[model samples]
Target: MPYVNIKVTREGVTETQKAALIKGVTDLLVEVLHKSPATTMVVIDEVDLDNWGIGGLPVTDYRRLAATSGQGSGSME
Candidate 1:
């Protein structure tokens, strides 16, 4: 069995978001890596806002950068 661990911030996480992430990852692993979703374990780890970073900056400043640019456009954000 193969295992995957994915970590993201916890502030805005939802069940649907988690499901999409898991499904997307599982799809890639199964289709590209020839892995079996039944046997593969994919885990998502959530972090506190204080712990994550964006564009060499902390998550605290991510929104400001996003406003300047666009959310999700920043490489590290």
Candidate 2:
């Protein structure tokens, strides 16, 4: 069995989007690694913005600083 964990901020994400993510991940594994969809598992976790941080700052603060500094988009890939 293949297990995958995906974490994102606690922003408003629709259920349809979450379903798509799970399906996409499963499909990717099937196509790339010959994994079976029945055995592939994908779990998503939503973390609070305050609980998520970057560069010693919360995501919200990081985005604010990034906006002011014009350094980065503050988007995680």
Q: Compared with the true structure, what per-residue lDDT tens digits does model 2 show for residues 1-77?
A: 79999999989889999999999999999999999999899999999999999989998988888889988765652
Q: In candidate 1, what are the lDDT values of residues 1-77, reduced to their tens digit?
A: 67899988777789998999889988999899899899988899999877888678778787677767765555454
Off by over 4 Å in 2: 74-77
Query: What lDDT does each candidate get?
Result: 0.82, 0.90
lDDT of predicted model 1: 0.82
* lDDT for residue 32 in candidate 1, whole number 0-100: 91
Tell me how many residue pairs clash in candidate 2: 0
RMSD of each: 3.4, 1.7
Weakest ten-residue segment in model 2 by summed lDDT: 68-77
How far is 1's C-alpha from truth in model 1 (Å)?
Answer: 2.4
Candidate topping TM-score: 2
Which residue ranges in model 1 land beyond 4 Å of their true spot?
Answer: 54-56, 62-76
